[model samples]
Structure formats: structure tokens, C-alpha cells
Target: MIKFFRKIRQNLLSEGKTAKYFKYAMGEIILVVIGILIALQINNWNEEKKYQKQLHIKVHSILGDIREDALQIKALLKDLEKQHSAADHIIPIMESEQKAIVDSLKFILDFNSFTTTPILSQQNNTWDYLSANGILSELEDQELVNLLMNYYNYFDELTINFNNSANPVRLELRELKYELFTNTEHRKFFPTKKPSVPSKAVYESIFNDIRILPLCRYIGSTAAYFEGRFKDVDQKAEKIIYYLETNYQPI
Candidate 1:
């Protein structure tokens, strides 16, 4: 194609049609400019297609992370329910003057239950990557982006609260456990170790401790509070997952 254009230019130059040659040369330059523009446009289109594909993969990965978070939240909620149940059962018996003679094993088990703290493992690696790289703004769905920001921010606040508020309470509970229960009593709940149950007197000592009632109440209340928060976040995660799945296509 270049050789053909050169031959045409040479003919125009040799024919002594100077004005015509200038016009032809100008036309050839314009055509070359247009061709370059077209090539650039094509390259831009290819780059855009590649970007869309990468965005699709990232969004899908985010969906997977949210799904995993939802599952973890569900498990945490279940554990919280058990903790709440244990507190419910233990509190009334401790409060009553005529304490019901609950089974020693059952009392020990409930003691262990309310004291166990459920830690939520949030799946935020993809989100962290996007945020760190400034790719979150590249997401075209503004609503989804806002939702993600709010969701992660909420988690961050929750983590901070847990560290500042809940950790001390948990640590106190651990101290109380050591103070109230003997080593044999502590080992009773271990599944792998079939240690002999502590005497009834040991169980009664824990049950009679007035301090435990308030701690149980605190655990119960916090369990309920965190359960509500976990459910809320899980619902938001599910909403985000549904939106991504429904609106996005594989590129």
C-alpha cells in the first residue's frame, strides 16, 4: 500500500501538475491521519474490553468473599444463640433464693457455653485490594460502591468496639473462670479429654457466686447485640451478591 501511494505521488510530481500534486499530497496526508486515528480507536476499544473482563473477575471474587462472610456470620449467630441460651438458663437459677438443683454436668456445660466468645472472621481481602489500589472508584455501580464502603466501615467500627469494649469483658470472664472453677472442672467440657467430673460442691460454688450473674447478663446482652449486627451485615452482603450476580455478565 505504501509503494502504491509512492508511485502515485511520483506520477503526480512528474506530470508537471504542481497544483494537482499539492492537492494529492495533502489528501494523502489526511488519509494517513485518518488511518492513524482509526488504529488508535481500535486500540482503545481493545483496552476497554480487557478492562471490562478484569473488572468482571474482580466483582465475581468480591461476591465470593461476601458469600463466605455471610456463612461466617450465620455460624457466629448460631454460636451467639447458644451463648444467649446458656445465660438465660443460668441467670434465673442463680437469682432465685430456692435455687433449682440443676444437674452438675449441665451447669458446668452452661458455664462453659456463656463464657465462650465467637470471633467473626470477615472476608475482606478483595475489598482491601481494591481499596488499596484505588480501583474501588473504577466500579461503575455507584450504589454498590457506596454500599460496600458503608459495609466495610461498619465492620471496622465493630472491630474497634470489640477490641476496646468487649475484649476487657472477655478477659474478665476468663479471670472469673479461673477463680471460680478448678482445673478438673475446666477440663470437664473438653471433648478429647474425658476427665472425671468435678464434685457437686465445686459446681455449687460456681452456681452460688453472685458475681457470675451480672457477667452472664453482660454476655447475654452482648451476644444479642452482636447477633443483630451480624444479621444486618449478612443481609447487606447478600444484597450486594445478588446485585452483582444479576447485573454483571462474563466478558
Candidate 2:
């Protein structure tokens, strides 16, 4: 193609048609520019297609994360509901100083399932992409961003509060070690390998021992609060699923 154009220019110049040669040269430059522009436009189109494909994959991965998160939240919700019920039963009995309440304490103690590591792991990085990269602006539903924002705020607060206040049950447990272990009657609860060795002050304190009803109630209330939060999360998750289905393509 270059040789054809160069030959035409040489023929025009050899015939002393200087003005005509200049005109032809300008026309050739225009054609070259048009070709370059067309090539650039095609390149851009191909790049956009690739980007859209990658974006679809990213959205699908995030959708999977959200689905798994919903399942985890469901499990936590079920556990919380059960804990709330058990606490309700035990709270009343605790007031009456029933020995059965002692066994019920184990229910609360055994309630731990997913550690903090897994809870944080469930939070998808898509939220960060939306916030940091303005990706959420591209989402068809702005409400999806709002839903995720609300979830982030709620979970942040809940995790902070829980981390700060979670150990009261463990703290109240020290009293059991000090006071109850000394009681010869309670010795059956302790293993013989680690004999009960309460000090005389511990023994003397039992007569004046105060119940930890407040602590137990507080723990139960905290569990119930977390349960309510998870219920809200579950609802938001449904909305997220709807958003994904409506706006995002699986491919």
C-alpha cells in the first residue's frame, strides 16, 4: 500500500504537477489518519469487551461470597435463637438459685462456633471496591450500595461492642472456681486429678456468696442483640441477591 502511494506521488512530481502532487500527498495523509483512527477505535472496542467479561466474573465471585455469607448468618441466627430461649429459661431459674442453672451455664459457654477470623472472612472485598474505586456507581441499583453500607456500619459497631464486652462470663467464672470448688458437696463436679483447693477465705465467703444473676442476664441480652442484628443482615442479604439477579450477568 505504501509503495502504491509513493509511485503515485513520484508520477505527479515528474510531470511537474507540483500543486496536484501536494493535493494528493495531503489526501494520502488524511487517509492514513482515518485508518489509524479506525484501528484505534477497534482496539478500544476489544478492550472494553474484555473488561466487561472480567467484570462479570468479579460480580459472580462477589455473589458467591454473599451467598456463603447468608448461610453463615443463618446458622448464627439459629444458634442465637436457641441461646435466647435457653437464657430465658435459665434467667428465671437463676433468680430462684436453682442448681440447674449451674448446668445451664455450660449452654452459654458451649455456644461459641465461628471465631472472629471466619466472621471477618465472610465480608466480601466488593464493598471495598465500591467504596474505594467508585465501582458501586456503576451498579443499576443505588440501593444496593446503601444496603451494603448499612451492613458494614452495623457489623462494625456490633463487632466492636462484642469484643469489648464479651468476656464478662469468663470473669464471673472466677467466682465459681473460688467459691463453689471449696464446697465438699460440689467436689463431685471437679476432677479428682485437680483437687479442689479453696482457701479458708473462699470457704468463709460461701455463706455470704452473692449470685451472679446480673452477669448472666447481661450475657443473654448481648446474645439476643446479636441475634437481632443477624436477622437484619439476613434480610439485607435477600435484597443483595435480588440486586445481583436483576443487574448482573453470570457470564
lDDT of 2 by residue, 213-248 (tens): 555566667677877877887887778778888888
Point out the worst 10-residue segment of candidate 1 by lDDT: 188-197
Q: State how far residue 198 of model 1 sits from its true place (Å).
A: 4.0
List per-prediction Cα lDDT, in the order shown: 0.78, 0.62
- Give per-residue CA lDDT, model 1, range 8-43, as digits (tens): 888988888889889989999999999999999999
> Lowest lDDT 10-mer window, candidate 2?
109-118
Candidate that scores best on lDDT: 1
TM-score of each: 0.89, 0.70
